[model samples]
Target: MGSLIPCLDLNLIPDYSIAVTPKSEPKLEPLDEELYFSTPNPISNSDPNPDPNSDVIQEFSPVSDITGEESDVFSQYYRISQLFQSVFARKLPQHSDLTVVDPNSLAIVPQPEETGVSAAVLNYKKHSRSAEMIRVSTLAVEDARYFRNLVRTTRMLYDSLRIFSSLEDESGRTIGKRMRGDLRAASLMKSRGLWLNRDKRIIGSIPGIYVGDVFFFRMELCVIGLHGQPQAGIDYVSASQSSNGEPIATSIVVSGGYEDDEDAGDEIIYTGQGGQDRQLARQCVHQKLEGGNLALERSKYYGIEIRVIRGFKYERSITSKIYVYDGLYRIVDCWFDVGKSGFGVYKYRLVRMADQPEMGSAVLKFAGNLRTKPLAARPSGYLSLDISKGRETLPVLLFNDIDSDQEPLLFEYLPKPVFPPYAFQQLGNNFGCDCVSGCSSGCFCAQRNGGEFPYDRNGILLMGKPLILECGSFCCCPPTCQNRVTQKGVKHRLEVFRSRETGWGVRSLDLIPAGSFICEYTGVVLAREQVALFTMNGDSLVYPSRFPKKWVEWGDLSQVFSEFMRPAYPSIPPLNFAVDVSTMRNVACYFSHSSSPNVMVQYVLYDHLNILYPHLMLFAMENIPPLRELSLDYGVADDWGGKLAICN
Candidate 1:
């Protein structure tokens, strides 16, 4: 094929733009094998029964036009036309009488393959066709705009319809299987012992046999892992339903030999309803077979197992149970206490439990390390249970920190959860077991004193930084200090206190003063309960769980306001810092006595040195001294003998 790329100004093109040209036709060696073309244009026929993708176009020749000097532009267009003809010839069979062929026959050139081609090839053809169409539209400047818009609209509509059809099919499938109680759906088609989608088929392995065939999978559900005793089986659920609203299985068979059909025992009836009941039924069936009572002829089985693993006294104990349903209202599993001490090992054999023993009770396994290789012995004392009712149950797993005996609560694995796992919806206290410290961090059973933060007095929690107190730690010591200097400067108003007795007064401080760093206060952030009872604008707020309320809420409000204030800052934005002079220790702790005071707290300046802008005189408290303690009396009387009106 000849090179026919339009001469685009090098300076006008972006880096991603590449010249469109055909590679040079390399000289064929004597030993080179000749290339072959199809005898007929497979893409020309629209046979419905042909290979699903036989008619799909593979490569498209773009019509490159040069819009420049008449001769040069026509020459470029001619070369592009010649190149298109060459590619067409390369992909089509030779004709004995070329002169007899029809001119319109160029439309059907590249023959299709018996099977579909790669997506890459199809995409390339689409882009090439799009480029050709665009070039054709550009012939007339006015026609370019209209044609571009029309093409864009058509492509958009096609994409929208494709997505809409896909969604519609999915909705139909979901609705059709809604009546089934099983949590999983079996694809009408199956492959590789795994589930497949009913609508879209999976593309076969790349560059392998049957590469273009559509593959199907069914939603298969089996017990993935057993947590507790071998006797206590795990719960399984499916969403598929029968026309009469009966639950159906959603999985395919994997493995397991039934020595005798009778050995599997009578079919366990799941009287309960909902997704949970179905799961519980599956668990029950598993436990019955795992336990010797309902013998399993085959030793090995391929299926997901769910069980309740109970941990106490720093060690984990697993229990096995059989899920049984008593109508829709009650669905639970029966626990079989088969004593075994294999941690992390999946056990299949099970034994019956002595009673409906509560799971959280202290129990220890001492025969061998649970992590060691599994034993074939008929281990006794594995706990199991029947699903009594409801889709959930308070976790029977107990966690006790060795540092502090306080028990940590964990929720059991509910196959048919009321809500999808980790949804963070609803206020239910039953959060799944602490997956953070469990699987990810690796369970350190012997760590910590409840694994929580501690707090200090004064309602201040220091976190991520250090704090220092100049004065010695004050724990209700009598105040005693002298020679305290409290001075307010004209330019930078400052208050200096000289204490001799206690710390901040005039008695103990000496004249020759050299500053020295005080001991640092090192502590972590306080517990949420430390300041549970605080007021924001006099509206009481409480700590909810481990997070703070009100104060943090106000901080958030300030931050949002600051965002809007950015454009108007220094002109309309209000100042951020507000010093509270009500308290003597606070810089803004100024006091006054007046029913109708003239002064009020207002934005002063961005800098700390500047006082309140447009300074409003203070109505100072009565008997105020130069060095005496300053206190703000909120409920003081004015000279007119009226009570001060406090806003909040």
Candidate 2:
């Protein structure tokens, strides 16, 4: 095979400007062995399934007339063509394994498996294809416009269909190099387990994963050491965990927790005896510890596991085990360093993906953690629920999924939600133990609170972090179980107040402590497509460049301009759903925007998993004084980096 690519259609090259001669042979150099691809072309009849990649074209089929000077340009097109043809098309490596493949005979290309950090590698050999592609797009291409068109169109169309974009041309205007990089950086494809979008500003941390001190993570090196954790020392080792019993590191499989790590505190490290670690300050690392560079570096790949060393379950079978592979977490950062215990340690944080399956054993083992005591769980709502109902002066946060659009309370008519219909949803499963003993080990309902109620006597979240599992109707216990804190509706007094900057905002009527469980944002749950229909101005919501057309046509003003004069910010995704409070809502609908926000929305996953939407549970990030405006950082910033006006 001489040519590594099929003869692409002449008309199909959307960005092609001039003609190409069939005589233009590939001037591609033997850069390295890391490239391979396939495209269908003519094959012999004897072998029906010939590898399209097996044969290569020696001479090019002329797409259009080309100049003699353009021979070098074709080589670049050939390089990128390889990457464009390839897909993941393979299973993820198992148990931290890496593999090498042969590019030519399709045999393994030999390379040393044992490579060390800080060893300068032949990067040109490793990144040759990317370098060639970048060169062609940057230096070789005579027309910047042409490069922009082909690259952006290909990226957008390929992403939208979740397949190769065979189409040469798409409808909208093509983005330039700068815009493409920005959009790509901001973009996050959870299904792909990758984040490369560079220009997008991240305003918050992934919940439970980056809590407390280890707040700085962005796909780079990080450090984590389990030396002096509170439970044991740094790594949650139990006193019984020793060489004679279980290794201290192994004890983390059972006794380690997220809170313990946060409370363990920082272990500062310096370059010399003095503060010579300029690299630390330059990176603005918020945590003061370091050391675990290898674990952090290797974890950047998709499907790689940031094993928390907690007990989840052994793979392939469902049985209890100490070492929990806390799903496949991305390694945002890691490093090497010293500990606060006056010893060397590594400190880094692994952010849990927003949603994923737990280990099979972990799920089953959780069923045994509930206590026999009566759960204090009860219906969640305000004490004045009866008084607030149907009142025009203030909003009543009804949690029911009723479809009624009640009268306007502050700005316009908002639909009031009754509390989440958990009681009714629970009727389907008998996982709830008999209400008499509350939730017990025998009751699968106890898994909601790790086999115990999640709250103290005063109903505060026991550790300020919980995978809340409120007792459903299936529970044998009464509704007042302490495990039912989130279900026990709005305890904080809040009211809607008109704002000069934002349309309306919510303010606390009483003081609220840090980490307080605030009210959930309730409304008619609708898919992204459904939200687009009513939202006139679709400019406020943050979305990838590829999704702008789906939210609203930029060229179409009437479709985007709302009657209120502000651009509508409808959160859009391929299928992201929104909780529409336009018709009926609680005081949460009036929450304003804050760069340094006091509260943020967290999806509570317990019994029912609504794939279209997670229950948007709001939690206070810090203490709030009485009469202070309650707000959240919605993460939709404008070009100038200011929070959008519609966030309130």
Candidate 3:
């Protein structure tokens, strides 16, 4: 009766296919080294499996949105598409024991047997080692020493697994299963052991790890949600599950709380020495986000701040600046740029900041230790402390020796401490704008192009340099405004047009001279020490970074810039710096390739304006053309089609 009942909806049984699974057979021997990296001989496409064009089940009907908004349907399609991709794109056959009856079919099959412990461990360890080796070898660690260490460690673990397997009981089925699982877990732990290289000695594994049945990899990814924080999502894709599967990535919704707050917000409490409310302005973000710390995003985390009453005096003729982390620590001293080029110094000590008499005595003792000069200390300077007198005196000590020029200011130190700038200081406007003091008539701000040139103050250009309005009107936001200020070199080309009575004409152009000074790019200058404390990797460490582009380091100028600057602008001539060839790019420009020619492209030497203030005189090689609308090449063997392949 049940077989006959299906006659009404006979079409429901859609055509599908059963994919055959090969019987498992252990290899006769362990894999050879060559087989580890053997070339994949894929089954030729011409030799298709039986019913290769068919599927094992009816394709799942895509869920349609009855409510037909274009956006809603599109979104539904996207979600369904992703889910379908995840299922069908699996590496191993998605289902087993199924026959293909239809070409275009889909169905939900019972889950396959779990990838047992042995298979999982083997795949996971191989995948893990590959990723680690790739990253370790790519870093500037001199050749592949780091990668070698990883390979060595992996080999050692492989040996351990072999020994553990031999010791297990082959006859006790239950015990054998447990023993294999234990060995798999051990192998995983051994692989992860390399991550602790900074502390662990190469002596041996942590105790009990070899004996234990635990592997941290089994722990599932944990999602943590903090209150008042943005909703977040994290996806951990296993390396085996990805296309190519060579490297797996774990991306997360980086919470804002973990990052440093550039604008010294409520999380940062600035208490004065005497608890007096004096204004203390935090160093600008340009300084905070500089140096090796260039990758740090400042708007997310709370900062501990301790500042010298006058930090520059200790290190320079100017006030010495010391960053006391988090309003609390008298424990660590983070010294930053003292305005004197690259001289940065740091030290640590404990300070007591409390109200009791003991607290004062403790602070005084700490101050005494800090005041102690090194054997090489110059006789010209010393340290001083200012204490707020309450029930107990709170001591505020300087990091370096105070200078005579700054003595009066220290003597005039108020009982109250100056509060650094708060995050909310200007909710109306963004940070860094309060830089230029006062309001003036028609001050309309420097138009970056019109009225007064902003770089005029820095004096890099001798008042004759052309001004471009490219660096936005001063009224723009910081991000946009900074980008405008960084216009330099070929990037600053001006579009000149000729127009007649029709207000437009054939805009015939003229040639520019080689070594011509393009418009000056203007921006702020920061000391190298400041950058060291603030910036992260990937951000430039040059003292005079123009927003996104950092100035090349003097040491690296020849090696790094030579490669980057040569043929950097396809429309312009190549620059002569001694940089690595990896950085050069071939761009298209005017070229009349000739077996022999009158004008030959040659490397031209152009002097860069001092990077400090009023970034001016961005010079690029141009032509002293004897003809009209012609491009000249810097003729050199390297510049001709080899390294400079873009040449004509």
Best by lDDT: 2
Q: 1-648 in candidate 3: lDDT tens per residue?
A: 001111111122222342222111110111111111122212211221212111011121221222222232212122222322233323213224222232233222323453332221222222222112111112332223333334323323332222222222221211112223223323333333322222211111111111101111111111010000011111212223212221111112111111121122212211100111112222112223221121011101112111111001112101121111111222232233322122221112223233312221122223233335322333433233321112112232222232223322222223211212231133333211232433221133332222232222111111112222222222433432322333322321121111121111111011222223333222222344434544554332222122111111101112111222211211221221121111221111112222111122211111111112222223322121111112222233222112123211
Better of 2 and 3 by TM-score: 2
lDDT of each: 0.19, 0.31, 0.21
**Candidate 3 stretches greater than 4 Å from native:** 1-111, 115-123, 127-473, 478-648
Candidate 2 residue 171 C-alpha distance from true site, Å: 64
Better of 1 and 3 by lDDT: 3
Q: Where is model 2 more than 4 Å wrong at Cα?
A: 1-427, 440-443, 448-452, 462-467, 501-503, 532-575, 605-612, 638-648
Arranged by lDDT with the best first, the candidates are 2, 3, 1
Backbone clashes per model, in order? 97, 80, 61
- Quote the lDDT for 291 in model 3: 13
Winner by lDDT between candidate 2 and candidate 1: 2
Cα lDDT over the full model 1: 0.19
Q: Give the per-residue lDDT of model 1 (tens digit) for 378-436.
A: 14221211111122221111111122321111112221212112222234322222332
CA displacement after TM-score superposition, residue 589 of candidate 3 (Å): 41
Per-residue lDDT of model 2, residues 453-542, tens digit only: 434345533222213456644456776765565656676655544444455556554345444577876666655665587576553332
